[model samples]
Target: MPVYLSRTANFLLTEEQLKGLLKRYDINGDGRLSKKELQVAFRGLGLNFSGFRARRALQHADADNDGFITDEEMKELITYAAKWGFTVN
Candidate 1:
């Protein structure tokens, strides 16, 4: 299970914690997040429209337009996700 998905529902996730949790979804072990991986991450965060959220995240954070969120882009992605104030239990 994704780390965030396993967290307690009342637990408020910090940006740093969200960052680490998101990183664990890099299924290809490429150290980067693809849109699909991001979708799953958003779903793990208990989002209803994960697909839309993932696309928005890419748009907001994929600086190179390469269709993947690399390490450098991760900060921006985290910042974006942080705005939602995700709470996982």
Candidate 2:
């Protein structure tokens, strides 16, 4: 579900695809997303400031304050990602 975008093209990802894409970055196979994992995921999406973005993502989506993005919190994360767009450019 990793999408490549041109500078002039805008691609919007479906929630399911976005979710799957993010889940694929769970390096520890923990069924959750840690800050580091999220940094990698954001980098994969061709985003800058991935570390900062990851921290913000956790802040916005880590509902339980557990420092991880559980399945239950994925919707907010997906929304956040979508809002920012997955465009490579």
TM-score of each: 0.78, 0.81
Candidate 1 deviates by what RMSD?
4.9
TM-score, prediction 2: 0.81
Query: Candidate 1 has what TM-score?
Result: 0.78
Q: Listing every candidate in turn, what is its Cα RMSD in Å to the true structure after a full C-alpha superposition? A: 4.9, 4.2
Q: Write the per-residue lDDT of candidate 2 for residues 1-89, one digit (tens) a residue.
A: 34433322566555666788889999999999999999998888778889999999999999999999999999888666655654321
* Colliding pairs, model 2: none
What is the clash count for each candidate, in the order shown? 4, 0
lDDT of all predictions, in order shown? 0.78, 0.80
lDDT of 2 at 75: 81
- Candidate 1, residues 1-89: lDDT per residue as tens digits? 11232333754555566678889999999999999999998887678788998999999999999999998998788667655654323
Q: What is the lDDT of candidate 1?
A: 0.78
